[model samples]
Target: MNIDLEDELAAGMREHTADLKPSADLLDRAARRNRRRTAAMASGTGVFALAAVVAVAMTALGGTPAAPPVEPGAPPAPELLTVAMVQERAVAALAADDVQHIVSTVDYRGKTEHGEWWFDQVTGDSRITRLQAPGGAVTMDLWQLVRDDKLTMTQVFHDDRSYLVLERPLDGQRPPGPAGSTPDELRAALQRGEGYTLVGPEDLAGRAVLHLRFDFADGSDELWVDAETYRAVRRETVKHTPDGDARNRLEFEWQPRDDGSLKPLAVKVPDGYTQRQVPPVDGPM
Candidate 1:
């Protein structure tokens, strides 16, 4: 595992679990489900190989050939897709603008894990697009455009002051801020063909994936891709910050529905956390 990949994975773990605070009813159900899954993963049955490429490609079919390589550090030259192309597909997939369910968990001190997210998307010209957490404390404030998506944070029943700006738009691009937006940007960054080395293909939990190592000034990232589909499946990032060494890991499993929409059916959140629905916007505001 490379540094970048480790750091990213850790970050994903933290980000995914940062806020729990759910109701007892929701918490009980979530904890029961997560414990079962976590046990499955920790069972260590050598099932990681089943998750690499085969599982990802079996979700949806694509029309592209093999990708050169898009890991962190090695050769900077590779045949990759452009940002525009990636976004085009994502946008088309999200055109209907249905709800976005975010199933996640959080880890406190690297111990127990518990969490889940279900977001209902609201589209159209409302500059104030909101991702209502169906039973939690966080809501995503998305600045939406037809061609770009930017993220910010908002508390359910509080003032806008709690808002935190996430990623901004790219130069000259005012795209819609849908669920597919940022992933599309990340895809573009990967396709730019400039910042990684190829490590060859490998297997993940019941899937076949391509492995790439990335290098940075102070650290690095290890990326896992679905070999057949050319989409990222997991990333681990490692960085040496001023405070200390930080590691983040992120794993994503997406299944494209017949409607062309991608859905995340499960996510493993670290321990000591709860996920709940955000209050409705029409309530008391």
Candidate 2:
């Protein structure tokens, strides 16, 4: 029985075993499944690589970067010279101009005066005419002339025939120190910025101008300088006095002749007018 047991088991296993083969359709289905799995893995890898590249690009380009923080009560950055350095340039330009023609209007104490002035830088010659309205009516007309450093004043009455002319000496007398009258003086005053400040930019006579202010011991002056030419276009002065507040305004119009020279001005006494010669004053005219 022991000897027959091994052979009987072998024969029994052999009898139960049967030969089987895979079909063409089953093999085709298995190949298709393997290809789909490979394709899916490749697509996932490509998406990961694309995401990494996008992240790098954003970092290099500084996308959505944060701004620097500012400290409390910190002073602002310095402005460019175009805005702050204009005053100095204006002063220099005005000082360099040799000849000037000015038309001005003055309003003081409820009275208005219109004036015309011509100045010669080389010969120190000037002519000035003023038309004044005392009380809303044209009441007075004054003319002043300067030639070869000599000054004369003429006053005309209601009747043009009655006019008084007074001749005065022009020696050692300082010229009027209005904002635009003396370029050298104004330049010096502005250089000392202790009391000078730039108000801002404004429109004057249809042109861009810089508004500057100067505070002095006696009064304060407001000047409007052309932005492009650096010329003083307008000026206003307010003086403090015991009597009251004295205010003055000066407007300048620079007229250069076609020859690029100063226009000539002539001042001659009217016909049949009596001329009076008076002693010269010791002061400046």
Candidate 3:
């Protein structure tokens, strides 16, 4: 009996459980648990994949990226304005203000002379009142009026008793150049100029302005235009001379009437003055 005890126990245990089988409910529960674990693992993997895709999409769409930190104390650069843009703005501003009053002063050969100009853009009429030196010796006050394509000049002599008046057609009486206080003339001069440079912003007569320099064949021009209105405020012309340079300056101040009409400019002939009429010529008079 001692010798067969281990073999007998093994045989009895096998025979007792020979008909055993798992219940259907238990099998179903095990399958459901397996499916749930599989579904949860798939969901977690999908979430990770979706997160990666979203990050890639944001980068592709140029989403806001981190900016490099800027230095603590740096000044920004000033904006640059072009010459053509300034000229265009100036021309537009001048055209909007159709009337202009200009005071020009010329200093040459130790002589200083003052001139006044009135220009009407709508009527194309102008008046110049100045002192002229005909032969470089005597200075006489002269008034020049341009109306209806005609020029009339009245000169008051030194004695104040004798005066001279001359009238001529203006078709070819003057050379082809900037002939008025209009900004169109300045724009044209800038277009035909050889060298153009922006001298930077400056203060002229207590007003901010842009300083522009242009060179021509015989002379050069320095123009100061208002920063806000883009209108010409002052201009200086330097003419090359054998002895020295002759500087001519023009200062413009616009006076727009409250009625939106041009101011009247009167030029009258002196009493008992000699009148002379010049015959119309083809070239400059």
Candidate 4:
């Protein structure tokens, strides 16, 4: 939007303002919403470098004389969004009003796994599925459902054609993952984006998003968040595990819960699959 706006603005403007930059008000508007660190953006690295952009845009557009230069080492004004604020918004994505859907990809040790998870934050009900190496093969499946105030978990291993069902009390058990997905667990993976820097605003799937990058002790990651909703949209990370460097990509969407949406989330057992008394050595998710 800024780029297109700048182009259109430059076309109709006079030559004196040809060097005009983005509006300071626009940057401030974004900052108010994003809550980025004021100190960091002062370096004029990203779009928040409003000291130069605003001065140039305002002076040229207003036809005013340029201001005198500072003596030296003047502090730069700050504005723009940051990772912490976005994560805060995304962490609240588990609003009881609707269901949260997450699509995740994990690439590790020469194999790739794709997963989809759906969970009711308020009700603590969820359905999680995984496909290993594609080709329509489901490696793992799990579902937690609440019926008549009783909660139950069913775990399935398609390769072994076996499943385990256990009745669980709905007290304080948190959602488990790589099979289970929750907003808090998902946010924890990003470590609250401790030192992320802005890569600028970008468009993903026709939706406006903010891109941020960070490096941790063992790896680095890129996170994308919805500009309007402030929910997590996508993530890409490369981490050095004991085995090797693992790469993963996660995508998210918020869906309105309805009967139609429940069809796919329902637990289904194949006609010939056997029910097991115990889970695999890896344990139940």
Q: Which candidate gets the maximum TM-score versus the true structure?
A: 4
Comparison by TM-score, 1 against 4, better one: 4
Query: For residues 61-106, what per-residue lDDT tens digits would candidate 1 score against the true structure?
Result: 2223233333353222223333233334433543343433333332
Clashing pairs in 4: none
List the candidates' TM-scores in order.
0.36, 0.55, 0.55, 0.60
What is the model-wide C-alpha lDDT for candidate 2?
0.52
Model 1 residue 12 lDDT score: 36
lDDT of each model, Cα atoms only? Answer: 0.40, 0.52, 0.56, 0.62
Winner by lDDT? 4
Compute the lDDT for candidate 3.
0.56
Off by over 4 Å in 1: 1-181, 257-285
Model 2, 120-194: lDDT tens per residue?
554455555554532233333455556556666666553454566776677855334223555665576567657
Candidate 3 clashing pairs, residues 3+ apart or interchain: none
Q: Cα RMSD to native, each candidate?
A: 19.5, 32.0, 31.6, 11.3
- Can you tell me which runs of candidate 4 are displaced by over 4 Å? 1-96, 133-135, 146-151, 168-171, 177-181, 186-195, 279-285
Candidates 3 and 4, the one with greater lDDT: 4
